[model samples]
Target: MNLRQFEVFHAIMRTGTVTGAARLLNVTQPSVSTVLKHLEAQLRFRLFNRIGGRLQPTPEAQALLPDIDAVFSRLAAVQRLTQDLAGGRLGTLSVAAAFPIANGYMARAVASFLTGRPGMRMALQSLTTPQVVDRVASREVELGVVHEPVGSTEVDTELLLRSALAAVLPATHPLARLERIPLAALEDHPVITYLPQNLFRFHVDKALAEAGISPRIVAQVTVSLTGIMLARHGAGIALVEPLMLRSLDFPGLVARPLDPPVAFETVLIRPRGTPDSTVLARFVAHLRDVLRAEGLLPEGH
Candidate 1:
């Protein structure tokens, strides 16, 4: 029988009366009777019989009930899944972010957002700004978070926050005693920072150049996490983005503001000409809330 007829049969089996089936299906009693008649015509078997002025299941109907129930069960599951997907409660979220955020704040955001979402799947990637731009431009990922200024015009960008790089040093170090450390004060100290070619490193370099101070560079690393870890190991002072410091507790390390903050913009880069995603927006909200709570992102600005 067709789905409509099957639905009527299933409803009657559930309610045990044609009038009750019509009420359950939100249709008229005549329509429900008509569908059951057609279903019986196609099957060439009576699904119900009149007994004591009420409808009772036939022997054949008793055997068919199990299979029909199973089919309707599957249909209900399918409908539920479609509703969940349309409501943004179930789906795969493919996302990418720059190093510090990917390895740091993004984890907390994803974890908090995914709480109790059993049907949701996540794919998180960590890459440089150039790599993030590539994935966004190719639509390989739904969202990419990066620190500006990225030069790519292929993706639409929105600012997440304005933050800066800071100096992290051993707690016992002399620099840690100061509330803010000046770049020129590093003339004699060993400094660990990003590689010379990195975008964030450019800002630090410019600040140093404008101040005409060339600190002793003992180590050059890729991500801010690396610089923080190196400093934790007595590797002089680390100049790195301090966003992750909120989540990372290095007992031996302490972070201090730079004399002149090396500022940067955290941004969301997404595929151009695409529809907006509720999941992506919710994830971003979780990310910003985490950052704001940690003081990585200032409130209201």
Candidate 2:
């Protein structure tokens, strides 16, 4: 029998009479009787018996009651789950981000997001710019944060923040005396920064090439935080975006805006045509607020 027939059968079994089943289902008694007759005809057996004007379930109807109850139980669970998702009360959000954002602002933003979201879960992974793009485009991660100007056009991208590179140096370094360090000044000292494969490294290379200057290369690191740490130990000067500074707590390190600023953009990405979940959308909103307050996100956001 169909779902409606099963529903009518279940109601009749529960109340044990056509009049009571009609009342429970908010239908006329004659309508309930007609539906029950059709249901028994489809089943090719008698499901109920009318004796002394009282309806009694047959052995077969009693045997089928458990399965019908299970169906209703599962349906009720789906309804509850749907309500939770629509109300933003429960869901898991998976996000992939470049190292700087994952360690810095996103870490704090996630802590703040979990304050009252007891049933919500969040997974944050640190990856390179290209890896972030790949994960988002492949639908492996619902959201991505990375350095802007992503190479691929398969994902939807939005500028999340705009900030210039910062010059990180040892507290005792000579450039620490300058409010803004010029790129040419770095020529005198070894530079510890990202490896060439990184997207941001391309910009650093272009800027140096345009100036017709070659800075001493001390170390090639994977992320800005690593470069900053090395600079704190007097390895060399480190040039990094400002967001990277938020994750560091080196008391012996100093930061200055690069002169003739080398600006950069942070982008938010998602797989093309993938709809945003309520939980994901809420967390993204929270992230933007935190970045804006930290002065990472641009104004008029």
Candidate 3:
């Protein structure tokens, strides 16, 4: 009827006597007898017949034993899985990030995390900044990395890195001769930019506003990689963070630091009151180490 009842029945069937089942279960013989009686009453069938002071299992009990054993086996598996989750050994972490952060830093951090702790699983999704915040708030993602600081008090934010924005242009562009070009100087040229919905676009727009310049947008794309590719093909100059340009081998693209340098901040976000599990903490440390090695973190900070 219940797990305890089934367990008692199973033990009695194996041990062939109530007293032996009691010893196996670390209980009194009377307790085993009570459970066996209750199980047979609940099932409305005789599970055993007494023969020579031993329990001889009936045909019905013999037929039910396999199913009961299977149930207990699955229950044991569930127990083990719960233990593994609690121990931070088995579970899938849902991670959400803004585009380039997902591609650039988070990708490496996740790879390093898996290398250090194999068998841990993760599901990574790339989303816009607002989407990252929404996902964290809705408990869709256990951890989120995004460019914009989440405004909701329900989300805890940790500053990850502030990468300096660079001016990426075709190698033959005339401004390429200069060490760094001012933001206003690019207004007349066709400025290939990240889409307005992207986090990088938010930072770029804010910086341009601060610089008192209105960008003449030529083409807008979703990702930094796309912007760089467009810039390399002479679509227009792109404003992007330094790291985004690092892994690309576009021969025609030259990246120069913005003269009045603008920096974009990356923040790690999570739902407030969610305790930092061992897995998430390890991932945070791995991320910092990766950024530090890349010289993306502020000097001595």
Candidate 4:
């Protein structure tokens, strides 16, 4: 029998009356009766018996109830899953981000995004900018967040924000008393910063060159997080991006803007032709809200 006929027969067996079946199926009683008749004709067996103005399930109906119940149970589950998917409440997301972004703002964004999404499982990986770009290009991750420019033509990039580099120093350090640290002031003091090969270092070097002093480089770190940590523990002063520093709580450290602010672009990258899903769209909106609250986005954004 077709699905409609099976549905009507199952509903009649469930409530044991055509009137109840019609109400359950949102159909007229006559339509329900007609479907049951058609189903019986197809099956070559009566599914119900009329007794004293009431309907009773036939022996054949009693035997088929278990299978019909299972079918409807599965259909009910499918509907619930469909609703959850449409609502952006169910899915798996894979994301890769640069070390600083992961340790700072993206961490906060994920916590907020997953607040009520019990069905959305996610993976957040920390990688360098090149690694982040590679992951997105190869489709190993759905999205990548990094503070450096990505030259890959395999992905689409969107600049999220431009953030300034600041000097982080131990609270007890001499530079800590200054509201803004000039690059020249750091010339004689030991500094912990990006490796010369890194893209972020390019901006810092150019800014320092304009100040006409070479930084006294003691240690070079790949991630801003490492430099910040080092500076917190009486290490050399750190010149690094401040995006991740917004949420930091290093009791012994304070971050001061450079006299000439050095800025870098933070971008979100995705595979070129990737189609958007409801869950991904929801997460992007949630992420922007987090950035706005972090003061990383325009107030009206």
Q: Give me the candidate number with maximum lDDT.
A: 1
Q: What C-alpha lDDT does candidate 4 achieve relative to the native structure? A: 0.85
Clashes of each: 0, 0, 0, 0
Error of 4 at 196 (Å): 1.2
Minimal lDDT window, size 10, model 3: 240-249
Residue 110's lDDT in candidate 4: 89
- Estimate TM-scores for all models: 0.82, 0.71, 0.65, 0.87
lDDT of 4 at 24: 96
Please give, for residues 1-301, the per-residue lDDT of candidate 4 as tens digits.
Answer: 6778769877877787889899999989999877777778888988778998778888888898888888889999999999999888899988889887898888998888888889889999999899999999999999899876688899998887877899998878888899988888998899899998788899988898899998678889988888988887767999987656677777767899999888778888999988777888888888889889877799765
lDDT of 1 at 232: 86
Candidate 2 structure quality by residue, lDDT tens digits, 6-94:
77888888888899989999999999989988888888999988988878888998899899999988988999999888776788888
lDDT of 3: 0.82
TM-score of 4: 0.87
Predictions ranked by TM-score, top down?
4, 1, 2, 3
Candidate 1 residue runs with Cα over 4 Å from true position: 37-46, 87-89, 182-190, 210-218, 276-282, 298-301
Q: List the residue pairs that clash in candidate 3.
A: none
User: Which of candidates 2 and 3 reaches a greater TM-score?
Assistant: 2
lDDT of 1 by residue, 190-230 (tens): 99999977888889889989878898999999888888898
lDDT for 183 (candidate 1): 78
Worst lDDT window (10 residues) for model 1?
275-284
Pull out the clashing pairs in model 1. none
TM-score of 2: 0.71
Order of candidate numbers by lDDT, starting with the best:
1, 4, 2, 3
Winner of 1 and 4 under TM-score: 4
